[model samples]
Target: MKIIGIVDTTFARFDMGSAAVDEIKQYVSARIIRITVPGIKDLPVASKKLIEEQGCEIVMALGMPGAAEKDKMCAHEASTGIIQAQLMTNTHIIEVFVHEDEGKDEKELAFLMENRAREHARNVVDLLFKPEKLVKQAGTGQRQGFEDVGSLRG
Candidate 1:
């Protein structure tokens, strides 16, 4: 089974004959073909054609150009700081005007806020595992979904 997945051309140059490419050649079999696209915009179209021509049954893709990369930028500090910021802002605005942990309930609320942010980060990672299904269109000859994070955020 030959499988094709896309990668960012800016981040890595893909070679079908290279050892790394050979390793993921296929999700199931020994034969695999990895094609590097100039950008994320071209992955789906390329995969669709490859699926038809190469008889690719499953297309498992990976591109960490962004999503997870966000976490790796000062992982330790951001994890604590971002959540703390969210807690302080949301607590006063939404929950109640409690900035510091004076009571047991306030401390628990702060803890919950921190956990929620951490969970949000985990969700970000979970979604990053996919092409980010944002908008979907269905027609007689074409079906597509756009997952570009930049476009999604905008």
Candidate 2:
């Protein structure tokens, strides 16, 4: 059986990680292993260990960077490390980040984070089991925080 690793940080809103896992479980039958760290910076190493030691085929990393300049910088560093780990492990690490500044208020931020996490979890399932859905959507301008453009209908 295939396994998926879910790595999340405590600094983020608590619901995001659980939302992702819930969505994944609804879609696929793969075994999921979850690890929570203190901050986004720890996602990479934990993900690598999951892949190398725990035999995960892919990892889903969820984080919410605060709306400060330093926080963004730290998120960037964590993303870079995640990329390196992906390269080292030769596996996909889906990084789902919801910046606190993206929303107008606390409630909006929470909603956005939850939706994004669930969406990315669906992405993980598609990556593993149904690649054609992702492939068919490519270049359709369907991205995070935006409505699907769908080939620029005239």
Which candidate leads the pack in lDDT? 2
What lDDT tens digits, residue by residue, belong to model 2 across residues 22-58?
9999998999999999989999999999999999999
lDDT at 118, model 2: 88
TM-score for each model: 0.30, 0.94
Which parts of model 1 are misplaced by more than 4 Å? 1-8, 12-28, 67-154
Error of 2 at 101 (Å): 0.5
CA-only RMSD, every prediction: 18.8, 1.4
Output the number of the TM-score-best candidate: 2
Question: How far is 112's C-alpha from truth in model 2 (Å)?
Answer: 0.5
- Write out the backbone clash pairs for model 2: none
Model 1 collision count? 1
CA lDDT, every model vs. true structure:
0.32, 0.89
lDDT of 1: 0.32
Name the lDDT value of residue 5 in candidate 2. 95
Per-residue error at 18 for model 2, in Å?
0.7
